[model samples]
Structures are given as structure tokens and as C-alpha cells.
Target: MNTQPSALANSAGPVSGDSAAAKSRVLQIDRSCRLPLMFLIACSLVWLVAGGFLSLISSIKLHAPGFLSQSSWLTYGRVYPAAMNALWYGFAFQGAMAVALWLMCRLGRAELMGGKGILLGAFFWNVAVKLGVLGILAGASTGHSMLEMPGYVSPLLFVSYCLMGVWALVTFHFRQERQLYVSQWYLVGALFCFPWIFTAAQLLLVFHPVRGTLQAVVSGWYGHALITLWAVPIGLAVLFYFIPKLFGRQLHSRHLAAFGFWTLAAFGGWGGMHAGAPVPRWISSVSIAGGMMMILPLIAVALNWHLTARGAKGPENNQVFRFVQFGAIAFFAASLLDIGGSFRVIGEVTDLTVFTTGVKALYLYGFFGMTIAGAIYYLAPKITGCDWPSDQLAKLHYLGSVVGILVLVLGLVAGGILQGVRINNPEIPFVEAIRSTIPFLGLSTLGGLLLLAANLAFLVNVIRLLALCCCTNCFASNRSPAGSGPAAAGANL
Candidate 1:
């Protein structure tokens, strides 16, 4: 007895008559959500490619400034900042929205509300992000650090985010299921936290409501929290879904899961201060303590996931499971590094170096990036009503992402250590330290290329699947008699 409608209820494309009426209801809830998913994939791919080009250019400028001295737009300062904005806003954040919508639908047992509304939100969000990123490249930035995308950009961002947040909230409220699961807790908290933090940061930083180190404090707080508060929820929601679903088991301990969620929400806020500690020791200490305290919550989460999967069958043979499991492992590694890196002793040497970047990448790329990749692999076929266009392409996506991220992380860590060693050595020439990083930078560039290829492969697979879903003739052919016309076409293709 199938609880869901078999013929077309779960199907994301096409229906007729009695089914069509119900489908329209689902579609109303679905249309707005799916575009965000497609837009995210498109935007993330563009960012990945653009960021790769920028990284290569920035690397060249690092070793040799004369390489692009004539082009102000391609200069190291502009290229580096523009690349950061692209990766953060254009890729990572946008990707989070896609993941969030998917998770909300699956976990909450809800469909999208108004597709038109979602499209409008997507349009405004993309426009705002494009302008903000271009503003960074054009040096219209307000001289702010990570939040450098011009004053006007903040208001636009705020409005777009608010719309997205509301959509999530409404979707959650209308969810058909009872007793919301662990993923819903994370999704709801994430939806609420982002707006509060974003609004406060925008007001204090852009509106000039605060001054001096207070501004730095607010910025650092908001900056780091954006990852922990905004991105972490979606990532955790992915973990909640895939870790158990892949292994065919419920979570090992619901009590432990709740504890982890509440503890993380409580402790994640204070750890933002760690980034500002170089200027203010007290602030740094607070951040360091908060970061260290985060271990309890993280350990609980790690224990629950690992224990749950320990006795069950592993998903190693499946590509989606492989990507997600590896990413889950990295989450543990990243949290440990987060604590160590936030400490004053370690921060003294590694804060400005590539090691910090490596840790950050591990968190973003290794943890969050891999989780979403797995979800995309699992969800795309369901939504598109087709198998992946190419199994080889799926394998390529996994291998490329894994190998590329490892290469990139290793290079950054190695280069950073060398940088730290040289900086601590009073006798070492500053020029010598810079010279030593050239090889590592080259390796990082190659790694970026690998990751870019992986992303492109993923996009192609998605597009091909979407195309298949739209082909009603293709679906009709599949329903034909076994020995009749195009049986092999339905099977093999």
C-alpha cells in the first residue's frame, strides 16, 4: 500500500484531469521553489568558474605584480575581494537557499506555496547580488572588509533575504506532517537567525549606528555567524536527512540530537568574536572560549550520526552516499580545527595566513559543499522524473570534488605553515617567505580547475535530467508494452 500517489503524485512533471487538479495544487507550492534550485546551480557554476579565473590571476599577482599592472580591474586587491564576494554571495549563500528549500519540502512534508512569488524573489535576489559583486570589481566598495559590497547593496540584500525567509516560514507552517523532525528545527532556526543577524549587522555596519572597535566587533560577529547561523543549518539539515536515509536507520539518539541542536544555537553566537581578537584580547578570549565550548555540541552530533550508521549498511558503493559520508567526516575535522584556529596561541601565527583559508574552505567546500552535492544527486532524479544522464558524469562530479578540495586544502595548509614559520623567524626575509608560496599557489590554481570541472559536470547532468523530465513523449514511450516500440530506448537511454 503506497501512501503517496504512485502514477504522478511524487512526479514533478506532467499530469491530466483528476490528477491534474491535485497536481496544480502541488505545482503552486512547487513552482517558486524549483526555480531557486535551478538558479542556485546556475549561479554557483558561474561563481565557481569566475572564482577559479580570479584565483589564478591573484596567484600571478602574488608572485609577480607586473603580470597585470596595467589593468586596475584585474589587480590583486580588486581581484581578491571580487573573488571572495563571488564565492560567498554568488556561490555559497545562493547554494544554501536551494538546499534549504529542498530540505524544508522533504522534512516538513510541505510543497511550495506560490511559484510566481518565488520567481519574483529569485529575480530580485540575483539582481542585487550581481550589482553587489560588480560593485566590488569596480571599486565602488565602501572600504569595508568582507562586507565590502557598497552601501546601497545592503538594503537590497536585506529585502531579498527577507522575502526568502518569509517563503521558508510560510512553507514550514503549511507543512502537512505532524511533530516536526530534527531537520525542521534546524531549518526554522536558520530561517529566523539569518534575518535577525543580517538586519542587525546591516544597521550597525552600513547605517553607522555603531563606532570604533564596536563596529569591528559587530562585523566579525556577523561575518562568522553568517556561516554558523545561516549555512550550518542547511548543512546540518542535509546531514539529518542523508546520514540516516543512506544507511536505512533512524538517528541513534533523539535526545542527543536535540541536545546538539540547542547547544549549537546557544554557543554559536559568541564564537564570532574570535576573528576580532587581534585588536582586542578580551573579545578574542570570549570568542575562543565560545569556540572551545562548541565541542560538546559537535561531539554529540558526531556521536549520533556515526553511531547510527555504524551498525547499518554503508553507502560506499553509491556516489551520493560517498560524497555525503566524506563531507560528514570533514565536519568533525573542521569543528576541531575551528576551535584550535580560534585560540590566541594558534591565531598569532595562522590568522592572516593560508591556514585560516584552508580551514574555512574545509568547512565550506568539504562540509557544506559535499552535503549539497549529495542532496542534488539524490533529489534531481526524483524531481526530474529521470535517471541521471550519465553515471560516468556522476562519478566524475564526486571524484573531482573530493580530489580537488583535498589538493586545494593541502596546498593552503602547507603554504600557510611555511608562511607562519618564516614570519616567526626574525632572520628570514619577508620576500623569501612570499617567494616560497609560489609553488603552493600554483597547485591551488590546478585544484581550482579540478573543482570547476566537477561543478560543470554537475550542471550538465542536472540540465540533461531537466530536459528529460520535460519530454512527455519520453514518458509515454516508457509506458508502452515491453516488446513493443522503443523498449530498449526506454531502458538503455
Candidate 2:
């Protein structure tokens, strides 16, 4: 059963019935979001492309070693962190913000307020990110893992965030709907979670540097907490909202969802501390325990969603479901890998190898990226007042993302395992261990190429759709009858 009504989009049908009134509200919400969401999503896609390009450059350097040796700005040291931060701040955070705001307005029955301010905040955030990435290329990075952006710009990022964050809370505060949904729970949590994680990370790592092993401890905590707090919650928010609604089913269980949410809140940040970390032994032990304990929430969520979407098949025709399904599955796999890898036995083997790359790819690209893609696919038509202009490109992006991430994760994991094995063996020379990983690195490079191509297609599709809307709006404005103004023309967006 297709849950989405497809005959016409944003068509002003007879406003005679309850359904019409309901749709009018939906369109109103979409319209309120049109410009801001479109701008944020466009920025995200551009950053996504930049992140992919830098990542590919870094991956190639793993094997080729001299792909861009002539350029100081493109050195692996700079490019790798630059790539990660681009995805982190530039693509993922902005995209998540866009999705979070849209979800709030739609699910909570809230009108978006402070639209222009939100847009300004987004613009400044991008400026800060641009300067930060450039600073990294210029050797001004703070040298912290997640807080690599220079200290000078951190205030701007935080201030810019507050501009948006305060408004997000305000929107939710004034929502018409009295009952809060599960998706809103995750979204609200993420809205608060990011600031806590970022501020603490920046204060300790950047403004006033922590000393010795504690800095590493703090860095490790920040990196892991980011995935758990910011990324995972937002990704789950999207999944929980979309899966049942798109599949035409009610959620499986409220109790289970509450279970998942609370358990994740309690345990999520505690994981990602490794056994060998120089922190107190008990800290590592607690972290390891917390990580294993996270499986409880993971199982809870998997059950809630799986049971809800049980009868529905993966629909090729529905790009939203396809991407959402891919993301949900990846979330499970990635979470499991993250939990399982925390065991001392596994951690000892995979530490400092390409296996970490596989895990990051699985979590970031496979889980969160795909979820955002699905949300964009679902929201673009409503917000733009038009469906995608090209199906072929959408399908191409889907195939490429699914195949590319899978290949990259598997190749890196297998390669990393072998690489780790060689590193752990005293008889094996470090040089030999490095050489053993080259073949797998080559495979990951190929995967990166495919991923890059897919994103290019996605970018083109977005641009083409937006162009069509713009042209339609412009054309309509020129030929409109008397009293039919911008709002009337906007209906054709």
C-alpha cells in the first residue's frame, strides 16, 4: 500500500472536506519550510560532495601514497581530518538540523518561526565551517580528533548553533499537537545533545587543552558521544518517523520505544572507551560494559521498527522507503559492530588499523547518510511542490550508495583485520604489515570512487529539481492574472 497520495502534488483541489483541510495544513507546513530547508539541504549536498572528494583523496593515499604529494594542502594529515570535519560539521550537522526542524514542524504540528534568523545562522555556520576546513589545510587545526577546527572559530560555531537551537526549542514549545511522538523524543534529545557534546569537547580540547592521557580520554569520549548522542538519535528519529508511516502501519510498541530511548540515553555516551585507553582501568571497564549494554536499546529499536514494518516489502518505486530501509539495516549492523568491537580481544586486534575506517563508514555513511537521503527524497517533493525530475539519477544514486558503502566497509574491515594481525605479530615487520594492507586499501579506493559518483548524481538531481521549480515560479509570476501574487506563484514551487 502506497501511503503517499500520488495523483497530483500541491494541486489546489476542492477545499470542501476534512481531507482537503488536512492537506492544506500539510502544504502550509511545507511552504513555511520551503526556502530555509531548501537552502540548508543544498548546502549539505555541496558539503557532501566535498567530503567525498577529500575522503577519496585520503583513501587513495593509503595505497598510492603520493596521489597529491605535491600539494601541502592536500596532505593526508590535513585531508583526512578535513574530510571527516567536512562531513561532520558541513554535511551531517547541517543536514540533521534541516531534517530535525522539518520533523518538528510536521510531526509536532508546529509552525516554523524565526525562519530568516535560522537561515542566517545556517549561513554563518557554513562560513565558520569553510574557514575551519581551510584552517585545517593551513596547519591551524586544534589537533584534537573531533575538535580539529581552530579555537578562534569555535565561538562563532557555538553562537550560530544557539541561534538555530533556541528557535528549534521555541517551535517545539508552541506546537499545536499536545501529545509528543517518539520521533520528537529523539529529535528533542539530539537538539540538546549536540550542544553539550560540542561545548565540552571544545572547552577541554581547544580553549584550555587537557593534559596528557586525559586529553586522549576526552577526545575519545567526544568522538564516540557524537555518534551516540548526535548522529544516532537523529538517525533513529528519522527511521522511527518514516518506517511505519511510509509502510502504512502503526508503530509496534510504545513501551519498547521508551525502553530504547531511555536505555540509549543512559548507556550511549558511556561506550567507545577502549580497554587499553590510558584512563583509569575502571573507566575503561565501565565503558566496555556500557557498550555491551547498548545492545539492549539496539534490540529494542530493531524490534519496534521491524515489527511495525514487517509486512511491507522494500519498494523500489518508493525511494523514501528504499533509502530508509537501507539506513535502518545499516544502523543495526553498525551498532552491533561498534558494540562487538569494544571487547578487549576484538579491540586489541582492530585498534589503529583500517578496521576503524570500516566502522566509521558503516556508522556515518551507511546509517546516517542514507537516512538523510531518504528524508530528503520524501521531503523534497512536498517542499518544492514538485516531484523529482529524474528517476534514473535517483536510482543510480541508490545503487551506488548501497553498493559503494558495502564494498568500502567490507573491504576495509577484512583488510584491517589482516593488517591488525600482521601488526600484532612480532615476527612481522611493520613495513610488511603496511604492505599487506595495500590490496584492501585499493579496494576501498574503488569504493570511494563509486560513492563519489553516486553523490554527484544526487547533487545533479537536486539542482535539476530546484531549477524546475524556480523556472516554474518565475514563469508563473510573469504571466499571472491580477491579484495572483508570489503566494500564488509559490504554489508551483
* Highest lDDT model number: 2
Q: What is the Cα-based lDDT of residue 85 in candidate 1?
A: 73
User: lDDT by residue for model 1 over 91-163, one digit each (tens)?
Assistant: 7766777777766765555665543445466668778878887887787876556687888887887787777
Clashes of each: 2, 1
The best candidate in terms of TM-score = 2
| TM-score to native of every candidate shown | 0.87, 0.93
Model 1, 442: alpha-carbon shift in Å? 2.3
- What are the lDDT scores of the predictions, listed in order? 0.72, 0.84
- CA deviation > 4 Å runs, candidate 2: 1-18, 314-316, 478-493
Candidate 2 TM-score over all chains jointly:
0.93
In candidate 2, how many Å is residue 427 off?
Answer: 1.3
Candidate 2 has an lDDT of 0.84
Cα lDDT of model 2 by residue, 1-493, tens digit? 1243321110111111257666677677666777777888999999999999999999999899878899899899999999999998999988898888888877756556677778889999999999999999998988888789999889999999888777778778877665667888899998898889889988888778788888888888889889998899999999988887776666778789999999999988896568887788988898889889889999999999888778776555789989998999999999988887888899898877889889989989999999999999988888778889999999999999999999899889999999989999999999999898898998998888999999999999999988987777546665533113223323432
The Cα error of candidate 1 at residue 90, in Å, is 1.7
Q: How far out, in Å, is residue 460 in model 1?
A: 2.3
